[model samples]
Target: MRQRRWFPPLALAVGLFAINVVARLIIRLGFDGNDAASGRASIIMFAVIGLTMAVWTFLACQRKRPSDWLLPDLVVGAIAALLLTVLVGPFISGGEPFKDGAGDFFAQIWLYAGFAIVGTLLGYWLAVLLGRDYRSRALKAFAERSKSKPRKVVRR
Candidate 1:
């Protein structure tokens, strides 16, 4: 059996998680005071995170056709990154991750999931719209099948 490589997705997840940590640390150190500044920092963080996921998804889709492993691996990486951002990031920033409340906790989860899912969908859909996805491949196959003529066997 061929062994599956786990390094690419794992590295991407860890890198994304590190981005979260850096954002948290910056917010904690430089924008910790004014409520408006903190809010802006948080929004910026979320935007950056979302955009990063979108770009990553877009590139992944362009690199290969859709497969079971592609989306699932991306989702897993996003979840892992999200967990690191929420569970461990705040500690590094000298703050509590769930300091706001449980509601905020779940909201972060929802937000991360929403961004990841939307980005993934957008990437794949864009590929499909451009005739570069599995649907396109199947359509091409169907066209070829319809165009080809079957050969008749000659009997003695």
Candidate 2:
């Protein structure tokens, strides 16, 4: 086993945090005048984050070692997003952190988790369908090359 590098996952987590900030900003700017609209906007923002994660997962699967990025990358990214949502978002909104109903807070967590799972599945399946998934493509290429060569037996 090799020691995993931290920089990529750290960068990914930072990127996730930036996404949360941008989403919050967008919701704040575009829907602040109406509470209902703001809530909808927030939900859309969360969906976008999930979509981003899905795309990232697909790209990561194109590599020889998809596992390298799957678990840690997502774990760190989700944590970063969660922290930003819980700790920073309310402050930016000029409200106490966690002031909103518990349902809203829990909803955020559920929405984020759902998005991450859906994104990961979407990415993985897309890679498989495109014949670019790490293991699938590797196996295909190996079979092709083996079929092209003649096998020889030696007695020693």
Which model scores highest in lDDT?
2
For each candidate in turn, the TM-score is 0.78, 0.86
Q: Which residue runs of candidate 1 sit more than 4 Å off their true CA positions?
A: 1-4, 141-156
Q: TM-score winner among the candidates?
A: 2
Worst 10 residues of 1 by lDDT: 1-10
Residue pairs with backbone overlap in model 2 = none
Itemize residue pairs with steric clashes in candidate 1: none
Given candidate 2, what's the lDDT at residue 112?
75
Per-residue CA lDDT of model 2 for 10-66, tens digit only, reads: 666677777777766776777677888877777777787778787888887888476
Q: On residues 43-141, what C-alpha lDDT tens digit does candidate 1 reach at each position?
A: 777777777777776666655656744766686788789888889887887878789898988887887777767777777777777876666867888
lDDT (CA) per prediction: 0.75, 0.76
Global lDDT for candidate 2?
A: 0.76
